[model samples]
Target chain A: MSSSTQTAQYNPAYHRFTLFLAICTFLLIVAGALVTSNDAGLAVPDWPTSFGSLYRIPPMVGGIKYEHGHRMLAEFVGLLTIILAVWTQRKEARSWMRKLGWFMLLLVIIQGLLGGLTVKMRLPWYVSTAHAMVAQTFFSLTILMTVFASRRWIGSTVTLTRHPDPGALSFRNLALLTVLAVYMQLFFGAGFRHGGLHFFPHVVGAGIATVILVWASFSGILRFGNIKPIRGASIAILGLLVIQLLLGFGAYMTRVVWGKDAVQPRPSMVATTVAHVAVGALLLAHCFMLAVQAYRNLAPAAELSPADQKAVVA
Target chain B: MKFRFGLLLILLVAGCSKNETPPASYKPEAPTAKIDPSTTATVSGVVTYTGDVPKAQPIDMSQDPACVLGKVPPNFGEAYAINKGRAANVYVYIKDGLGNYSYPTPPPATLDQKGCRYVPHVLGLMVGQKLRILNSDPAMHNIHSMAHENDGWNESQYPGGDAIEKTFNKPELMIPVQCNNHPWMKMYVNVLSNPFFAVTDAEGKYTISGLPPGTYTLGFVHEKMGEKTLKITVGAKEHAVAGPAFSSADIK
Candidate 1:
């Protein structure tokens, strides 16, 4: 259970590949956001084919670039996910990890179907919103797989043998709550972007999510700063939150204020809105990772009876 | 790595099999009956509004400098072109009572993109009639046809590019055409089976002449205010007046 012994279990190549896949997934998200921002969801008009040909590259002009570029990137990401799953199944010793890989594959396939449905159905608000939400989920899964394959996770497995700290347990619970709040806010944000829901709910969700995230990050830093993984993820989440807020404000100004009279999607509006969405995805992933790290590094206090707690303390 | 390459090959092959051809363009059949000018009646109307008219909002075309470099910026609030309570751009057409007597298709309709706005905000054309979409502005524009009944298309057109020729096969009430490059640029294209439709001009006056004598349902459609129908009986060589008044309550 020692750190040095756990190092033997770490697969650096697999971990690096997973991290690469996660980065690509994030880029795919950015591409998808650009497509929505440019209002080019139906630029190609057909699914699985761009302008009636899949192999032949269409003219990447105007909205077609954003729409077709997104599809190409998604295909690349889908290929990466397939490789990741197959590798995990063949090499990973953990049965749960293998299952997680296959689950990611399933999610990616579902994501692709939802994207096709969004286009074939002419961007129905619900289908488009669901496509956006599923992209977030797929990105989070990649992040989770990346975290699971990290050396830190392997080394921290020994923490399970130590006595459960009640404070860390509460912090873990708070991190989980923060993750849920961030996800709910993302749902509202997707709904607003797709025109299914009004902006009021998204704004309100942002306020609530910000409050909970700030509380969780500050508490994690103040109480669990000694834990490397928890402190690192908490600090990253706080930094991402600041950038996300500024981007959100810029998006609002560009989209609602300056962009009100714009005949077309302005470069500034598209940039800021896409950045806000990208940062929102990053914030969600970081929040989820923080929760996962807390759970991995700190055992739940509820699992220990009073006698067992006393014995462990002694 | 070999497995990954093999999997990629499989995906590429799998994608090759899904060759879905684009839907065929709809073409309307030629008219069967000829119109008699001597027996035809005229339907004229003044589209008047009873409620407060929405103020015209100034459009900011600064996003695309070419939109205002040498041209006047269009008014975004053209959605409600009301002059002293008279509404312009209202599409008044025969909704019913044509009795399957088809009329000859009219000449091609032109939807020009000048100053980053559709020249005619609202237009009506016979089904299967050619629609020439021209981009006269210096900036790039994408013409997106949001047609529910017909095939939808989104194509980008460069400034001074060749005109895009399109035709609708079915009689759809209205198909919204927009330029995604400029969100403020929008126009409605109404396709009809017969040539008995007219759009109200600046004075809110619309005249639809050469209609065969018959009982017809006149449909007045405003972009914001939903459709209003009126039953009218037109006599031969007679001029029928359709004074359809749309109020704020009719806003859809």
Candidate 2:
């Protein structure tokens, strides 16, 4: 009964570390985008090492800069994930969250191996595309952790118990659906990038994703726009999606259309395409946060907020 | 649902199975031309502009943050640059009316991106002459050519990247080169078949040599002002300076 009564305590250090991991994930996603944009996936042409050395000797310029730089950043994030997992295992009170920490550490390690395997295997379409998908997932997971560790989320129960707002199923359902739609689009994007002949489908999928995401974001905003956290997440999701749409169109023109005749170092093409790909990670993270917020707000028939109990008892 | 997803994965892999392979032993033909040295004359002149000179406006490099990796490029907008009563960046060449007298193509010309701006804002090359593009800045530079006559190409070169080797197969008067990454970065390249072209410098002076002694129509092209064609004769061993200062009134 005491365990049931005890509210989740806010841990500022854990929250800060979770935020750091989220930022790192975002940077890693951007770095990965640069590698693909510069066509530098094979620039280093070696795995787990640059040019067969631990140190990038003689210093590579151009494409290799992006490739090697991405590797270094990813490794740093991988180390950070391990440290976070160990800390969470030791200090975190929630059993499910602790397991999640360990699972995320496992995901980061697998992601690291995929990064190396992608390079060593000469960027096979399957492996490379999977690597990109995993990156989005890992980034989303980091965002989930960031949301779960937030001051707002830790004090969520108190707000729900006092405010007694209706648990709108529309927002919750839309949030869950948005996550699935985003993952599907990311898979298509990965295949499209690798020339997996999924470009046509990917383009169509983008159109569908735009509609679904807009609807979902609108639904959330309509239902719980009064709440600060929900409003912020909803607006961010919509804004990032709009940016992603513009970048996607720009990328298509420069890369898919002008790509055939383009000379080396096509500047505008790379930037637009990279932004398009990287924004997906941001959108995915936002969607996952929206889902977590929805879950926090909507619970039916069991373990109702104290305010809900008050209504029932009266 | 799981089975369908697995099938889609297999379909994706199979669809991407097609691999690209370069053509074997593919090489473009070498360029060759015969220059008639007999009775050849030179054309020289000062390209003065009669208009209000537009001052150089500072270029906004806000789009590409890395443009300032080295030294920042000075202001752009050289549409009409005049100093001491002389026009710079005036393009002059023999537009037409030369009969079948071919000249050997010169060596490749160089266009460098030093401070996120192309050094020598305008350059000329023989149709088959190579263009060596280098990125001297620490940021990335891409060359996107919008040419109506020659084949258009877009190339990317990171800082310290290998020099790009490119060539034009047809005569194009002015090919607009765009740096797509840094939208403001732009340069013009002129490709002609004959080696009878020159752009004016700070003093607004240019000389066209290796011209066969004959009457030919000389053309002047300015970036913003307009273009002009004037009939001129290259008398035997004559150094015909272009007469009549080019004024903005003549610009359409």
Candidate 3:
């Protein structure tokens, strides 16, 4: 089948909306990071409400600005996710895509619950760490959905069947491994933030994840540079990796070196730490996107089962 | 001879009456000794530091403009609160030797958040004594107690909000209380079983009075200097002086 045949199920508006939701999710991650960086997780004290009222707007002063603002943005993104899921279910032709839509909804619901639990339990390390991990998962799912719905993804499916690359499977494996490494690193980072894990684990995980990410990105560029989706994602991940490392160092300096005697959370500390967390989320999402693209567009058709083949075309 | 016999019989009867047991309703009087200042002992001490004091670092309250609205930003690196050679904010308490004597809870202690700082940074209160937290600044504050032995709690207080009254049910030494909104606002609450504890003032002077005369382990705790203990014997109506000298090497 040609690209045009596969394009029938692709909705341009839905594709754009998915991308928009993904961006919003990234922003929400930033806001959430701000809350942690400022230690404002318990500023509002109540879950699902600011100062015991759902409708009443509490004065956004001090930590409330970061915490309550994060909640507001989170609610907006939740609404967006709901619309995206419902729209996908009603309009998408693929059963797997519809399932994915519902699954994303479920993940988002769990993410919100984790958020509430983190606050209600007064920022328990486990719950807060879970909240951070789930957020990254939900964000990665959004990115995956966006890539799957793109025009590039539709055209690549047809093109890959005609010209099969034997190294595609290895590349896909490498990408997946990079995803796991990055996700584990993020878990350790979140654990460190919530005081569940020590800083040593996070630091060690960062080094290992960095090596894997660099190797995977280089492999994608060297072997599959012609593939736009794979190359683009690889480049994005590489760029974000650099920025992440620098932000990580900046965060460390502000939090440990310069802030050693700080009486309060300094603005620089909050800024650097929040940016580091935001960039880390973006890096994870992009890494997952690369893995998905490699799996769907680079892998040989013979390796896919009949169901997988049908889902790919659909 | 008859009168002498009568006298001897009378004397024998009196001696027999003295040897007889008392009535069932008869009870002896209670002891008059109590835990009064005149009868009890006082522990007076000065916490002195022999090493160089850490200089205070200027706090950056620019994150919240309300924290520095009209007042100058304060420096806070001095974790030991050393002035001249004396240490302020040192919690001096009778750590041991009060065997079975129970004490009533003291009056409620007040901790205020003013200028984005905790007033009376180190406080000692008896177990079950109320702690009234007030926000005197125009900024919002959340009091988060990081208690290990007691139940931890976090509550928000808006600007000009009502005072938050809390009581610790267990004896927890040095429970850290922090304002998450204003991270610089920190305090340590010492929940003690007895009322014989005092925090050193600016001059490093502390007097723990009304202590029953006995040998005790006087504990001196600082936020950064770890802890030091002294063995002292207190006599009735005596003022026992126990001065603990902390060195910079003791900083932990």
Evaluate candidate 3 and give its CAPRI docking class based on DockQ. Answer: acceptable
For each candidate, report what fraction of the true interface contacts it reproduces. Answer: 0.21, 0.00, 0.63
Chain A TM-score vs. truth, each candidate? 0.91, 0.89, 0.90
Candidates' lDDT values, in order?
0.81, 0.74, 0.81
Error of 1 at B43 (Å): 4.6
Off by over 4 Å in 3: A1-8, A162-169, A300-314, B1-38, B74-78
Off by over 4 Å in 1: A1-8, A159-170, A302-314, B1-90, B94-121, B125-144, B147-174, B179-185, B191-195, B200-205, B211-252
Q: Tens digits of per-residue lDDT for model 1 on A60-118?
A: 65566788889999999999999999998888777778888998998898789778877
Better of 1 and 3 by DockQ: 3
Question: What are the per-residue Cα lDDT tens digits for candidate 3 across B86-168?
Answer: 99999999889875565666889999988888888999988778999999988888899988777777888878999999888
> For each candidate, what's the DockQ?
0.19, 0.03, 0.24
Ranking by lDDT: 3, 1, 2
Tell me the TM-score of chain B in each candidate: 0.87, 0.81, 0.84
Query: If both were scored by DockQ, which would come out higher, candidate 1 or candidate 2?
Result: 1
Q: What is the C-alpha lDDT profile of model 3 across A119-188, one tens digit per residue?
A: 7667768678878988988888888888778877654555554213355447788889988998898889
- For candidate 1, list the clashing residue pairs, or say none: A263-B182, A263-B183, A263-B184, A264-B181, A264-B182, A264-B183
Predict model 2's lDDT versus the native: 0.74
Tens-place lDDT per residue, model 1, B1-252, is 366346434544433432355555555555567777899999897999988765555666665567777765454658888888899999999999886576667889999998878999999988789999998887777788888887777776768999999988788876888775566678899988788899999999999989899999999998889899999999999998986899978765
